[model samples]
Target chain A: MSTTPAFKRLPRAVREQQMLDAAVRVFSRRGFHAASMDEIADDAGISKPMVYAYLGAKEEVFIACLHREGTRLMEAIAAVVDPDLPPDEQLWRGLRAFFGFVGAHRDGWAVLYRQARGEQPFAGQLAQMRTRMVEVVAGMLGRATAAEGREVPATELDVMAYALVGATESLADWLADHPEADPERTATRMMNVAWLGAAELLRGNTWHPSG
Target chain B: MSTTPAFKRLPRAVREQQMLDAAVRVFSRRGFHAASMDEIADDAGISKPMVYAYLGAKEEVFIACLHREGTRLMEAIAAVVDPDLPPDEQLWRGLRAFFGFVGAHRDGWAVLYRQARGEQPFAGQLAQMRTRMVEVVAGMLGRATAAEGREVPATELDVMAYALVGATESLADWLADHPEADPERTATRMMNVAWLGAAELLRGNTWHPSG
Candidate 1:
């Protein structure tokens, strides 16, 4: 038998991922403050010193986890959306992907996202990720409107995108909290609210207040 | 001249308001962690011990500010909403009041609300306020659907309310960040997005995914 542990035989990249997976579980279960590095190392089947050497301190480990999860979420959405598809289809697909990710990773959504939302440094990172999502949504809206020969103002598109992103996020939070809810149905409900309003807007139908 | 200071003559209720105003300003300028009781006292023109006597510690002072601001926001929305009015009209009035409040108190929104969102104790308070808002919104939605002879499920109404509240909150955050933005105009934009979709839903029009 080899003297080295089996984990030692793995490549550095693979080891790093294993550490991140363990870290995510710990962070999810214990939150940012209560979570300990020792637990993370134990969960990863690696020693504490090796965990620190590989991913730095606890905060650094958390940031790495956040970055990985965020990247995975973005990649999940990006993989499904195609510019060539109709706007409604793109939105439906994007939303379905988003809710699916949240549903599957409820713990990650609760701890990484909800916890980071109110905290300082993590909030900034989360904000950066949100800005990217808003930009992507705005681009999709812009393309959708252009296809319909309407030139909506960038600010308007941005605001609408903000609303959409915010609404979707709120639903994701709701989904994370509800263990019995179906992600696809939640996505469908979102489409009913989002796509309907967006379609009405694209059709130049405005809701004017009646006195 | 009287031996007592001029501030001493003020009623307890009046004095408390003064302290809270100062606390809100300090908390806004210097987030939750960075804000100090000393600065709050100085700004309010009250003594540090007096400030502590009135509002307790820094955390308590922050909570007091949050409670006051949240109460004011809820009152603003409640005052504008009338059951006799059409659902769309009621929604418009509520949204206008909400944006108006946010516009008038951008600092409070940034500090009291945003800062509390990620932090622990304050986050719980904020969630309570959000739940109240969601309830109010769901009630309005239920009334609107009932008037139209539709009996929507409570869970569905709650979900829709969550999406609306989330979207509105997102836009309010945007408005707070954009000093040049007009609150009324922002409210109108929100109306366009919200009312339009809600109107469609009321009319029994739903967006279906096309293969």
Candidate 2:
């Protein structure tokens, strides 16, 4: 063997991926500030400097984790939602995908939604992610309403989108505490709520006791 | 002059209350770890040792704030919820009170909900508050469904409560970002969703489109 170092490690790209996986697990548990680069490196079975070299600083690691997890979540919903399907079915598909994603990746959802809030440097980035999420729902809501020739005012549309997203996120946090609850059951329950909620709003149906 | 200081000069109870108020403000903004007892004492126009004397420690101060705010929020809701009112009206009343209180005492709500989540010693207390909230909604749901001669399944009731509470909390967060949104409007939108959503679920009326 040559005098130079003989035992080479994994490539930079693979190491970066490992570091991100470690970061997500750590960040989700400890939140951002409490989670350290050294812990992430130890979790990844690599040295701290090597992990830094692949993932930059701690903030970059967090951003990278969010980007990956966010993309995965968005794609999960997009994959389930077929434009060719009817509006209601499309909405159902999206809600199901969302609840399912949260059920499966509770940690990732927590890190993105709960842990990401309150911090300054990441707050803007979190806001951007939230905007992207709201836009996706708003687009779907607009399309669904338009397909029925119903015109939902822009402001109402925005409120509806926020309500839907908020309800789902809240359910996710509750689900985290109640792990005994089945994911399918949870998703169905949410789907029922979302479907009924969206339909009533779209048709301008108001709830009052029978008079 | 009396050797003892007059109540006007500063009673212990008054000083303690002042310290608690200052602690709430600082802890709400900077969270538990970031907030210092010195700053809290300064904010209260007292010395650091006094803060320690009244509150014991930083964590103790945070727990005290949580208990105080949690009690205030629960009391606000209880004060608004009239036992004699119809279930739907009772829910509407509760929602209005909730949104109104959140809008008015935002710092308290932030301390109770956001900052309290990260700290372990306080999470149990926060969960207690959450349980009380869920119980409030569950009681309403139970009463609403009682007239139909059948109880809503506890699981389903839990899910509905989560959705309503989640929507309200989410709306509160959204309202924080967009202050122009009127509290009345926010309350109305939330009530509309809750009352309508609850109605459909109670009737077992799933909103699936006709195939």
What TM-score number comes out for model 1? 0.94
Once all C-alphas are superposed, what RMSD does model 2 give against the true structure? 4.8
State in Å the error of residue B70, model 1.
Answer: 0.7
lDDT of 1 by residue, A1-211 (tens): 4465767767877999999999999988988888999999999999999998888999999899999999999999999999999998999999999999999999998888977886778888998999999999999999999989999999989999999998999899889989899999899889888779988998888887676
Q: Give the poorly placed runs of model 1, Cα more than 4 Å off.
A: A1-10, B1-10
Give the number of the best model, judged by lDDT: 1
Say which docking band candidate 1 falls in: medium
Question: Lowest summed-lDDT stretch of 10 residues in model 1 chain A?
Answer: A1-10
For each candidate, what TM-score against the reference?
0.94, 0.84
* Share of true Cα-Cα contacts across chains kept by each model: 0.61, 0.44
In candidate 1, the residue pairs with backbone N, CA or C atoms under 3 Å apart (3 or more residues apart, or in different chains) clash, namely A118-B118
Candidate 1 chain B minimal-lDDT segment of 10 residues = B1-10
